[model samples]
Target: MVFLKILMERSRLPVKNFKEQIMSTIHDNPVVIIQGATGCGKTTQIPQYILDEFIQAGRASECNIVVTQVSLLKCVLILCARSP
Candidate 1:
């Protein structure tokens, strides 16, 4: 839990500031496109947000998330490493 708190604190990226808008848009749409500058947490945060939501709603088992990256394999690995 402490580790999670620390991670959350460190997640003060610009994209974190727009989390509500992003989640709302995702909930209301079947497909969404999010574009942001580099290091804005686009690669690390959004998918986690969606998965967290699914877990909270008791739909984790039903959730299947796939992220495709061209050259950000490190980000993907980091994200996976952070997962519980």
Candidate 2:
């Protein structure tokens, strides 16, 4: 889709430093720090990226993705708004 294409175009994972260092650290470490400016696509894009990769690898049902936020009300509101 158009959104996926846009995400791919702007993805920071393509950068060698980010891919090699940050991603590897995330894979190897129990906790990782991913700091970026607001609207930098960290929250939105990372989950989708992981989901897509999991699906592509035929492990969509087996994998569990947990996205947590501090604000429960905001999370509920966003989930409600996105629901059909």
Indicate the residue-level lDDT of 60 in model 2. Answer: 93
Model 1 Cα lDDT, one tens digit per residue, 24-49: 99889998778889889887889989
The TM-score that candidate 1 achieves is 0.70
lDDT per residue as tens, model 2, 1-84: 998987566665434235446556767988765656566666666666667768998999876666655477588999999999
lDDT of 2 at 72: 72
Q: Could you tell me how far off, in angstroms, the CA of residue 37 lies in candidate 1 after the best superposition?
A: 0.6
After superposition, which runs of candidate 1 have C-alpha atoms over 4 Å from their true positions? 1-6, 69-84
**Residue 63 C-alpha lDDT in model 1:** 87
The global Cα lDDT (0 to 1) of model 1 is 0.85
**Which pairs of residues clash in candidate 1, taking residues 3 or more apart in a chain or in different chains?**
none
**Candidate 2 structure lDDT:** 0.65
What is the C-alpha local distance difference test score of each model?
A: 0.85, 0.65
